[model samples]
Target: MRIAVAGGTGVVGRHVVAAVERAGHEAVVLSRGRGVDVATGSGLDAALEGVDAVVDTLNVTSLREKVATEFFTTTSRHLVAAGVRAGVGHHVLLSIVGIDRASGYGYYRAKLAQEEVVRAGDLPWSVVRATQFHEFPGQVLGQVPGPVGIMPRMRCRPVAAAEVGTYLAEVAAGPARGQAPEIAGPREEQMADMARRLLRARGRRRWVLPVDFPGAGAAFRGGALLPDGEGPRGSVTFDEWLSASQA
Candidate 1:
């Protein structure tokens, strides 16, 4: 099987590519860095040649609603159309678990729009909704902090991106399920505490103040983003992920 990873150079997408190859499938990396831009449909049709499935982990780091929506909508449309033309058998999309409930957030709104496009596309598709990654603590610390590293009050169940990647590969190899089961971490942790732990692991001493935000912040604090009922849980804990990073 030949699998095309649309954002193969990304944080989780890179691991998805590796997982696909490790599972004995040919992995093709599709990214703007490789002269293929999914958002613009550039080099997409050519890259779709011999592609059995497409795993879309493409992402844009923007808080702006229009920018986010445009990126996702355009990218998904191009990927699906090109996949149909190439006779690709399956289309797998990676999305956040709580996008449906938290559409007020700009990024989640884009993700939801992307989901709609995928569901309405001509190709058979699967949307794999996943919770936050343990690496998110690090990612957030860099983005949401001011003088000292602090995280706003929110609930989070952060899985390992590597685990998310593996799950994506598995879904890509199998027949499309339309909407796959949601994936999450083993346990839930407060965002501020997670940030503190990450800071401690990095040998930094700082106060992580937690602020209560309204709207989207309220949704996160209310646990809207945490996986409900049962979902697949990865084995690596936040501590485990940090230790491995050190090693």
Candidate 2:
């Protein structure tokens, strides 16, 4: 199979690329870094040429609602249009679980918009919604902090990004199922506690204070963003991810 991975160089996209190649499929990485700008439809046709399926894991590093939505919706539309033109059979997209339930958050709102566009696109598609990755706690700990490093109390079921990537690759190679079952980690965990543990693993003495954030924060705290009981759970624990980060 000749597969194209949009955003193939990104955080999770890289793992998808590797997994596709490992499965003896030809993987073409499509990204701005690879000369294909997904947001504007630049250089996309050439990338989709001779491609059988497209696995879209594209992402933008932004918290603003408009910017995130613009990036995703535009990119998704462009990818679907190009896929239809090139006769791409299956369009595989990686999305966040509970996006419909938590669209108040800017990022989740953008993701939901993107999913909607893909679902209504001309190509046959499969969308896989995965829970937050174990890496998210660490990413948050590094980004959101005061002098004392505070985090908000919330519930999360974090899967390994690599496992999500693997699931996406498997789905990309299989039949289009419209929307696949949501995927998540094996267990649920508290957000602040996970943040503190991440800090401790890094040998940092900063205190992780938990607070309530309005809007998006409240949604997170309300468990509006966690996956439900229908999906396959990944085996890796948060502690395992932490330990590996230390290595």
Candidate 3:
């Protein structure tokens, strides 16, 4: 099978690429580094040539709803259009679990928009919603940009990005299931506690504060972010990921 991974060089995308290749399939990377720009449809058709499946793991760091929505929708439309032209069979999207429930958040709303675009497209598509990555705490801290980190108090089941990537690869290679079972970690955890543990693992001396934010934050605190139904759970725990990462 020839698998093309959009945003193939990104955090989770990289793992998808690796897993695809490891599965004895040809992995074509659709990323800027490979001269395939998904956002504008540049070099995408050529890169997608002879591709059987396309796995989109592209990401945008913006917190603004408009910005994130535009990016996801535009890229998705382009990918679908090109996939139709290239005779690509399956279109796979990596999405966040419970984003629909937390639509109050700008980024989550953007993701919801992206999922809608993918679902409405002509090409056969599959949406794989996964929980927060183990590295999410670091990402949260990076957004704060301060000596003290302020993270939301939320219930989470953070999974390893690599596990999600591998799972996405498996899904992309098979027949399209409109919505695959949501994936999460083995154990439930608190977001703020995870952040503090992450900092402690890094041997950093900083105060990590947990706040009850408004809107989406409240939803998160209320368990809207955790996976609701039974689904695939990753093996790695936050503590294990943290310890190995720091080691």
Candidate 4:
């Protein structure tokens, strides 16, 4: 199978590319580094020329609804249009679990918009909603700059990016199923604890201050970000990820 991975240079996208190659499939990476911009539709048609399926892991670093929504919607439409032109069969999207349940968070709204675009498109598609990655705490830490890191009090079942990548590759190899079972970690964890543990593992002495994020994102504190009961689970734990990162 020839699979094209949008944003294949990203954190999870890299693993998806490796997973596809390990399964004896051709992995074509679509990214700015590869001279393919899904947002502007530049080089997309050529990159997706022989693609059998397309796995979109594209992302933007924006917390504003307008900015995030525009990015996801535009990129999704571009990918679907180009995929259709290339005769791509399946379109797999990596989305967040509980996006529909969450309100006030712009990022989740953007993801929902992206999903809607994919579903409304003509191509056969699959939506794989995965919980936050184990490395999410580190990402959060990077966003805040100070001696004390402000960690949001939220509930999440964080999974490993590699595991999610493997699942995405498997999905891309098969027929589109519309919506796949959500993927999450083995156990639910608090976002603050994850941040503290991540800092400890990194040998950083900064204090983590747990605070409630204002506005619609505060819904995350009430388990709006958690996966449902029947979703698939990843084996790697937060502790395991921290230990590996330290080593």
Candidate 5:
């Protein structure tokens, strides 16, 4: 199988590419760096010339609803249309768990729109909703400034990006299931605690402050972002991830 991975150079996308190759399948990367932009539909038709399946892990870093929604909707439309043209069979989309329950966040709202676009399209599609990645704590730390790192007071079952990648690859290798089971970490965890542990593992001494984020913070704190239903869960814990990062 020849799998085309949109945003193949990204964090999770890289693992998707690796998983595809590890499974003895060819991986076609679609990214701006490779002259293929899913958002603008530039160089997409040719990039997906012989693609059998498409794993869309494309992402946009934005907190505004309009920007995020536009990016997701446009890219999804382009991918579906191009996939149809290229005779791609399976269109697997990587989405976040609890997106339906948490429309307060701009990014979540955008993801919901993306899912809708894929479902409404003509291609055979599957939606794999996964929880936040283990790296999310570190990412949140980087976004905040000052001597103290502010952590959002939220509960999450953060799965490993690599595990999610492997699951997505397997999904793409098979027929589309429309909506696949959600994926999450083995246990629930506090985002602030994860940040503290991560910092300690890095041998860095910094004050980690936990605070409720404005606007969408309530949704996260209210557990609207946690995974629902019986879904596949990752074995890697935040502690294990921290230990590995130090190695």
Candidate 6:
């Protein structure tokens, strides 16, 4: 089987590619670095030729709803249309678990729009909604830099990016189930605490300010990011992952 990973060089995308190749499938990387621009579908059709499945792990770094929505919707539309023309069998999309409940967040709303675009498309699809990855806190901290790191006060069940990658590969190789089970971490952790721990693990001392923001922050603080469904869960805890990652 041939599997094309849309964000094949990304954090999760790299793991997906490794997992797919380890499973004895050809991994076609669809990225600008590989000459395939999935964001606009410019080089997608030729790249998707003879591809059996496509896993969209594409990511955009924007907190604005319009920007995120446009990126996701455009990439999703192009992928679906190209997959149909290329005769791809399965289309797997990586999404967050609580986008439906946490639409208060701009990025979540954009993700919801992207999911809608996927479902409305003519391709056989599956949506794997996972919780935040263990790297989420670090990502958040990097977005806003200061002498003290700003950490949002939120509860989350964070999984390993590698585990999500493996799950995506398995799903892509199978029949599309449309809204596949959500993947989450084994336990929930506070994002603010996680941020502090991350900084500490790096042997750095920086004050982390935990703020309970309104709207999206409220939803996150209210535990909207916690997975309610009994889905596939990773075995690695945050501390365990942190320990290994830091080592």
Q: Give the local distance difference test score of model 5.
A: 0.91
The estimated TM-scores of all candidates read 0.95, 0.95, 0.98, 0.97, 0.96, 0.98
* Poorly placed runs, candidate 2 (over 4 Å): none
lDDT of each: 0.87, 0.87, 0.92, 0.91, 0.91, 0.92
Which portions of model 6 miss their true places by more than 4 Å?
A: none
Off by over 4 Å in 5: none
What does candidate 5's lDDT look like per residue over 45-104, in tens digits? 999998999999998877678999999999999999999999999999999988877777
lDDT of 2 by residue, 142-206 (tens): 67666577666778898998898888989999989898999899888998888878878877887
Q: Give per-residue lDDT, candidate 5, residue 75.
A: 97
lDDT of 3: 0.92
**Residue 103: error of model 3 in Å?**
1.0
lDDT of 1 by residue, 40-67 (tens): 8989989999999999999888868899
Question: Model 3, poorest ten-residue lDDT window?
Answer: 210-219
Is candidate 2 or 6 superior in TM-score?
6
lDDT of 4 by residue, 1-247 (tens): 8999998999999999999999999999999889998989999999998899999998898888899999999999999999999999999999998888875666777889899999999999999999999988899899988899988888999999999999999999998999998889988999999998888878788889988776645678889888766867899998998898788
